[model samples]
Target: MANPVELTILIEKIKAKTAVVGVIGLGYVGLPLAVEFCKAGFRCIGFDIDEKKVNLLKEGKSYIKHIDEARIKTSLPLFTPTSDFSRLTEADCIIICVPTPLGRHHEPDLSYVLNTTRTIAQYISKGKLVVLESTTYPGTTDEEMKPILEAGGSGGLRAGEDFYLAFSPEREDPNNKDFSTSTIPKVVGGLTPQCLLAAQTLYDYIVVRTIPVSSTKVAEATKLLENIYRAVNIALVNELKVLFDKMGIDIWEVIEAAKTKPFGYQPFYPGPGLGGHCIPIDPFYLEWKAREYEVSTKFINLAGEVNTSMPQYVIQKTIDALSENGKSIKGAKVLILGMSYKKDLDDTRESPSLKLFDILQKKGAVVDYNDPYLPEMPKTRKYSFKKTSVALTAENLSSYDCVLISTDHSAYDPVFIASNSRLVVDTRNLIKDSHKYKGKIIKA
Candidate 1:
């Protein structure tokens, strides 16, 4: 229902890079997006409820490890970071990059998304374009947000008429060298055709490619499928890992051999557990949504079960290693190598290392951790550990009864750790030369 005149005006503003782009939630997803928008020559305003983050941006500092301070300093002239919701009126395009976490019962928790929508509704105006970049289930943009924006907000301006709405899931991979925010392709879906055009034109300036989909629901489902595919495949390898461990088969060597086939397969390695913001949580959004239609996601549910039980499996491996050394599980000093989920990054969101730490301490093992990326354990939604990273040294490694490698960081010297430690429980298969160590290493 939007007039061609209004749509043309929005497109022109984006083409000329004159539009004021606003991004809500200045976390890993939102901050990079705002920086990319600024790099595309648009004036970007970043909003966050946390004043600490806003102050850090104002000081030209970068909190995330992968995003350099040089990038933040360079974009300081065009970027504005603040906690003011009233400034929403000044933006021609608004993007929501808030968190969509799972509830205690694994239900899709849309509180952050819904609260952001209500706030946007208060200040949105005619001819403004609003796109959601937060990952959620299908029908969230049209079914949840459209009704709120159309109900007496912005003087009852109708969606696709006086205003525009769309969904483009945020694809942010922190510390990924091959893809940056601007280089990644964006899949955008709109509530209406005009809405799609408006949103796509705005994103075309920042991203390498814009893939326009049919509806917001399709875009929403696209994100879920991407993550659920990863969750399922990882679970498959993890299940196989346990089975192979029983048969004395090396899953790592099997993956190396299987990946020799160039055409038919993609390699997904198993680890302590699923980590990061997306894979562990995003699949459940679709699983939760499926329940409304009387459908059961048994495959996804079983994958979740397998991935969730990995930490316990790692714990049992530690116990077995300790027992073989004639040491009791309780009162044994165990050192954990690397706290981050993956190698070479400081991001600890939903990291399996945290679960390992918690389980080790509860089992009466004196646990300590070391990570070159993190000096201290970061506070997360579910964890609060008053512990700092322990230094990894020859003497320090030799002092511990057992050393468990939870994360395979590039900085770790597998030979040094294997040689120094009395017992090494290798969860990530870091110590490949176990033959030379002579029973020093045990693959978990």
Candidate 2:
């Protein structure tokens, strides 16, 4: 397998754009990646166990809003999604974009990454480049993944000399209008210099910016730190919001004023709670991993705890609102508007809406939600409310005793909801036009 002639043949194929680029775990991160590589003129093969996604993608349709349908359609022939691991040998380059969800005890679960590496190592040959794009704690790439590949293969071939291995963390922000897969600067760190150069060659062909780091741990920590900054700041604002709410002050307005200072205050607004993939989950992975070093990430751990309590807090407020109107939450029909974590995106991974729904149900309220982007939710830790769609009409809003704006999806007209709803608990300041709403809003 380490034959130089075989390696040279694979190199020629890659250089000639005839090499296949196989991507495992074709979800939000992987699909866009396959398209990017295909657009860069390589034949890309995507692997996902979900046959539904494979069928949908093969038909030139995109499930993600940020991804252009036509762009995907054009590259559909070059990009293929399959469920078989035996087909891994078809690719000259492999990228792992699988999920890295937290375990029961909040540990960094490298199971999916390990499973994928073991699968790929079986079919791996010389000159193939493997890049892990899944987010994890530091040292996962060189320390964890490198050995799995070398150990699994039949021949006792070394990592860098026989095959290239690297870690390039995915910086994808779903529903974000500003950044996309290709536009975001990709950070690459490999086990060896040749590994780095090979990975750079692949990414440079597709991504506009590629940053090479000293080692895999550096690249791993870079992603964690980026998300940690967000988690801590959001926690600070959430605390500020709680304090300011007690004083009958609006935190959004305060952020607006502070943002004008232009020097230090980078404004981060409070909401129902922390949601989305990176902010809500990535910080905890580091917190769990830091225990290995016997170092307590107190700030990160506290922020996670504080943010986790926010959904219950919002529910308590809504319950209070109901009680103030001489109504009990037990029989109340509460409609939550916006299910996606952010505005105008179909991604609902790690959305705060899950906790909100569970909390509302625990209070015995009849829970329902409205979101054009989401018709159903994939089950995740401790919460499993199959998303049932309801209209955001005048009558529907009027029926619910309380309407909570869980997520501020862009398409929702706040004026419409406020006018129709009996009582609205606005968490995201969706109904910021107080003059328009005539002060019927409870700013969370």
Per-residue lDDT tens digits for candidate 2, residues 1-444, read: 244664566567767888889999988899889998898899999999888888888888887777888988999778887887799978889999999987777777789999999898898777788999999988888888888888866767688788888899998887567788889989999887777777877888788899999887888999999988988899899989889989988899999999999697798888888777678889988887788899999888889887887887788889888888889999899999887788787777778887788888887989999988787765666677876779888999999999999888778998898888889999999888865765557887
- Model 1, 1-444: lDDT tens per residue? 687887888889888888899999998899999998888789999999999999999999999889999999999999999999899999999999998988888888999999999999998788899999999999999999998888746476899998899999988998899998889899999999999999999998889999999999999999999999999999999999999989999999999999999898999999999998899998789888898999999999999999999999999989988998999989999999989887989989889999999999999999989999999888988889888898889999999999999999999999899988999999898998787988879988
Score candidate 1 by TM-score against the native. 0.98
Q: How many backbone clashes does candidate 1 have?
A: 0
Please give each candidate's TM-score.
Answer: 0.98, 0.95
> How many steric clashes between backbone atoms does each model show?
0, 0
What's the distance in Å from true for residue 272, model 2?
1.3
Model 2 TM-score on a 0 to 1 scale: 0.95
* Index of the highest-lDDT prediction: 1
Question: Which consecutive 10 residues in model 2 have the weakest lDDT in total?
Answer: 1-10
Q: How accurate is candidate 2 locally (lDDT)?
A: 0.85
Candidate 1, residue 137: lDDT: 91
